[model samples]
Target: MGFFDLKAECAICNKQVGLHRFQIANKEWVCPECFKKCGFTAMTPIKTMTASQVQAALQEKEKSAEALKTFVATKKSDHF
Candidate 1:
């Protein structure tokens, strides 16, 4: 017996579809009929953040941390 049994219904046509014929995304089982009706000729592809974008995000996070640290240090010194 298979460990996983895949079964789903087309969102558009309401026809039963085997798991192998379609894909699940965002908790939705997208059948070919629904995909075609939605005008999606190809499967949605995954997107990866670019290295520069990632680096920029990290830099912004680090800047926020530094600002927080400076604020905390000033507040502590003032209390003492």
Candidate 2:
């Protein structure tokens, strides 16, 4: 069997990747052309956070949001 003998489908375009090779991301097959078009050289997972970690992140975001809101309100009042 030759190198091109292998057959697989591209993950991005869902097309056949026979003669032309494809890229693999997280065990997913992707065509070479589609890989370039999709602009993904590497794929990383963002699914390692636990429930409590997620909640902590959300709380931190809310605190920053509140701080920003307070700063904006003070600035708007000073301008008016």
Reference-based TM-score of each model: 0.34, 0.35
Give me the displacement of residue 74 in model 1, in angstroms. Answer: 74
Candidate 2, residue 62: lDDT: 63
Which ranges of candidate 1 are over 4 A from the true structure? Answer: 1-4, 43-80
Give me candidate 2's TM-score against the actual structure.
Answer: 0.35
What local lDDT score does residue 75 receive in model 1, on the 0 to 100 scale?
39
Local distance difference test, each candidate: 0.47, 0.51
- The lDDT of model 1 is 0.47
Number of the top candidate by TM-score?
2
Candidate 2 residue lDDT tens string, 1-80:
23456777655456777856543334445556654443334452213433343335446666877798877433335565
User: In candidate 1, what are the lDDT values of residues 32-66, reduced to their tens digit?
Assistant: 55454344445443123332433354466668777
* Clashing pairs in model 1, backbone N/Cα/C closer than 3 A: none
Backbone clash total for model 2 is 0
